[model samples]
Target: MSLISLLIALGAERHLSSPIWQFNFYYQHYLRLFNRISWINSSKSSASDNDGETATSSVIANTLFIAIPVVACYLIIEALDNSLLYLIVSTLVLIVCFGCIQTRNCYKQYLLAAFRGEPTTCELHHLQLLQDKNLMDMGFGQSLVWLNYRYFIAIMIFFVLFGAPGALAYRLLTKITEQNNTAVESDDIGSDLNKDVAADIQRSELPHAHNQAISVFSQKILFWLDWLPVRAVAFCYMLVGHFSKAMPVWLDDVFNIEKLPHVLLVDVAEASEDFMIEQGDCTAEPCLLVRLAKRTLLLCLAVIALLILTGVLS
Candidate 1:
């Protein structure tokens, strides 16, 4: 079921951009309903009554928000066990969680503009991609690589280990953190962002402190959650890319937890493939990194299929 769903989701992500596949419709609906609940409103009011939210409330709210959907998904899948409907519903969820059409479109447009020698238009699409995911801190190639890990690799690992609910949980947490990160500068986050967000929330200087604290709580959880998967991604880069060049960097940071996930990923990726080149070169750095990411994805899927065949995975 895992391998089947993976193949379906990946194929749909690549070939289909239809409105029916858009995840935002359901996502926004859930947000709207969740926000209108009486207790949710009361919780928010109390958290702001003191002009700040306690770490406890933020943790509870964030945990509940993710936990509710995850628990519900698990229940639904369990109830539909061993049926064709199970596969269909699970694949639909996975498809929605897998990729962003807008990001891909922006990248393609940027490349087109670059080839046409339109620097201004290239910059426009580049900014759109960065702003969409709060990835402005890195180079264009680096951002592309990071988004691949976020949208596909990380979600894939979680789904394989814990099924569709795991994927949904990771996606929801990512959405929270991504939105929080839009207003946060890289300098403000340093290497550790959780502490920084917590401090800012306590001071109540930042608008939306209640929401920011909730997001920061979720961010801390993501840091721990990303610990192993980020390293796994780096190991994949070593295999599918320049193994000799990527090995040391992977080994060095493989156990290091303080570095930002995207930073570590981009570092190994940048080393795995040489991105430095003269202007008007045939292959752009983003193109190379994106290709490396694709190879890594294929390699991962192959490994999963092999595991299923070997009776190591069910």
Candidate 2:
């Protein structure tokens, strides 16, 4: 299934402008509906002095929402290879039917507003009117909305159907090995040696040196994982924005032009910076790290979906 998702994602990447309008439309619709409902439920419960119960109910409702999508995804996976043509045709029809309604100018305006860093107070207020709590609850609702729509539901479906143990294993192994290596390196450099000797050892074992190694390993994994989907993201950005604007930023931020083939150092540096920024600005609306994480997540979901589809078809 993972392989199938990867292939589909890669194939999609080749034709970056392929209209996923339908898919995006339906997805956004469900997301908005789920979020609105969750917000209302949470607000009503919270206002009635049953905060705990409300929270619990909200969680359960969220769980149900999540479950439905996961089941739908699994069904899609089951139908993949057995009905390749049917799957393709169905997906296309879905895209077209949903896309027509979802591809409205108003939605594009909202997207542009997001990109341009405009406040979504109006949208938040509208959602709030449907409930009692304010925008903060709405924000939480949105997070819960994507938690199912984008991450757990999408990725789980792909991983379960495709057996993407390679990707999973690679991520796990690299993380574990990197942590062990860092501990060892830190221990080696922190011993009671003379200042000059310690400096020499530290030079040989720069703090970032271990990080660099881990970064390299991660990059390698992404290299394998990104064979198809990275381009898809790049293309999506291009279609929404302009090629020059989107591609250059993506190349510099995601591809790491300065580091190029060496993805680890760049990733580490970016990750570190992201952490610092998030910690510094706790109240900022969706910190840079969150945005990057979301993009990575979306990319992963797309890949996983493709893999599941491929596995079923094959």
Candidate 3:
């Protein structure tokens, strides 16, 4: 069932871009409903309330807001058992969890713009596709690596661990973080960005405490959820990319809590490309990076296939 659902989702990506395949649309609905019930925005008007109490309340409220619906959906799916409806419902849930159709299309367009030697145009296209304008500084290739890790690899890891419910939960957690961060940034209207989002990517900067405006509790939870799966992704880069170079970076940063996930991913991806440029005209670097990411995805699928063959994945 995992393989079938993955194949169906990938097939939809390859051959279709219909509104029915828009995961963001469905995800937004879920987010809206969750936000309405979340205590994340609750005021601390009570004089007796302290910081610890407020933080704890926010965490519990956010957790329950997202958890109840996901648990209910998982129970319904489980109750279907071996019915044909099980496959259909599970497939649909998996598809929505996989990602939005429009996002992938926008990424493809960004690549096309990159290939045309239009750096400015590429940046514009990328800004349109990604929620953070600061991410554009990573270049198209590195940005692709970051998004692929977040929206694809990480989500799949949770799916394998806890099925469809896990997948939805991970994506929702990401959405909630982004939404909260965006809201915080908007409120601090006078906050200067330093115009170094791209420059910071180049440095592979540490994940600073000051930059976090989102709930620290939720961020910690996401970091724990991402820890193992991200290592798996880095290992995939080593296997399919430059093994010697990629391995050291992977080993060094695998335990480093300060390093951001996307920065680590982009570092390995940048090193993994087997570019064949003769005169250093590396116009194909962005596309090649994307290809390497796809290869890594295929490698992961192959391993899952092997596990299934050995009667281990079922």
Candidate 4:
């Protein structure tokens, strides 16, 4: 099921280059609706609570709201046979349906608006939201790992268990867990710091080293998970971005700690296009090479999964 889902997703990517309307009509719409429900529930819980309890209750309510759909999806997938076929067919159908729902004139208007560099309200809102968050200067390798984890690791595992629908369920679970943990940690620290200046002062002394340790720990985990996927994703990004950049910087950062690989790559790439240029520099050619590389990796993963699946079945 997992392999099937991956195959379908990969195929979809090749066929549907810009399925933004499909994504919006199905996935994005549902996510936004769920977020609204979570927000409202949290607000109601907060309103009912006293001063200190409000924060905790709000967090709990939001977490519950986020979890419901994930659990429901998982149960549904587990209860069904041939779930992989169902997932792949349903996903494709939904995408096609969404694409059909958009009039030809609407798509043309969207293209024209995109060409004019006119931002949608959603884009504007997203940009504004990013302004409030702290942007980490995670090295290119680290950034790639994060993306792969979010896009591939979690989804792949869940899909293998049930199918693509299960992948969606896993993503929701992962998102909710991550959000809740972050919120709780932030709240605890914020509350403690608010109460005790002396304690905060003492804790601040080793903040740099503490943060570095956490970064190293995270990078180590990412490196292990991203051992194969990093190369696959980097190639994809290179194809998408049309940059003839080698991931030497990313590889170096993953292998060694001292070098600021991300910054160096950007600097070198800007200075000279020849710096990272390989033979056969055409976009389609490079994309073909990347696709080939990704397919090879996927083949390796498939073999491993087959062994495991065989053992389980036996």
The better-scoring model by TM-score among 3 and 4 is: 3
* Predicted candidate 2 versus true structure: per-residue lDDT over 65-113, tens digit per residue: 4455545554655566765654554343322221112112223444455
| Lowest lDDT block of 10, candidate 2 | 94-103
Indicate the worst ten consecutive residues by lDDT in candidate 4. 180-189
Off by over 4 Å in 1: 52-55, 181-206, 280-283
Question: What would the per-residue lDDT of candidate 4 be over residues 1-314, giving only the tens digit for each residue?
Answer: 44444555645643563544233234333434554554554554454444545444444544565456556655655666785556655455323322111222233343354456564732343232222221144322222233333444435544555444555544444333332212122221234432353333232222233334433443444334434443444443433343445444444444444433233333322221232445433232223433443443464456547855786511
RMSD for each of the candidates: 7.2, 21.0, 8.2, 12.9
lDDT of each: 0.77, 0.37, 0.65, 0.40
CA deviation > 4 Å runs, candidate 2: 1-5, 13-24, 32-49, 79-314
| Candidates sorted on TM-score, descending | 1, 3, 4, 2
Candidate 1 lDDT, 1-37, residue by residue in tens: 8889988988887776664565544554465556556
Q: Is candidate 2 or candidate 3 better by lDDT?
A: 3
Q: Which ten-residue region of model 1 has the weakest summed lDDT?
A: 182-191
lDDT of 3 by residue, 1-314 (tens): 77777777666655544544555555444444554442443332221144445554555666775698689879988898675787778667777667544446667777676567676776686665455423435666677777777777777667766788888888877766655433222211222321232232223212232133235766778777777777778789889989997788888898897777777778888777767645433346667887898899888878777776787876
Best by TM-score: 1
- What local lDDT does model 4 show for residue 203? 28
Count steric clashes of candidate 2: 14
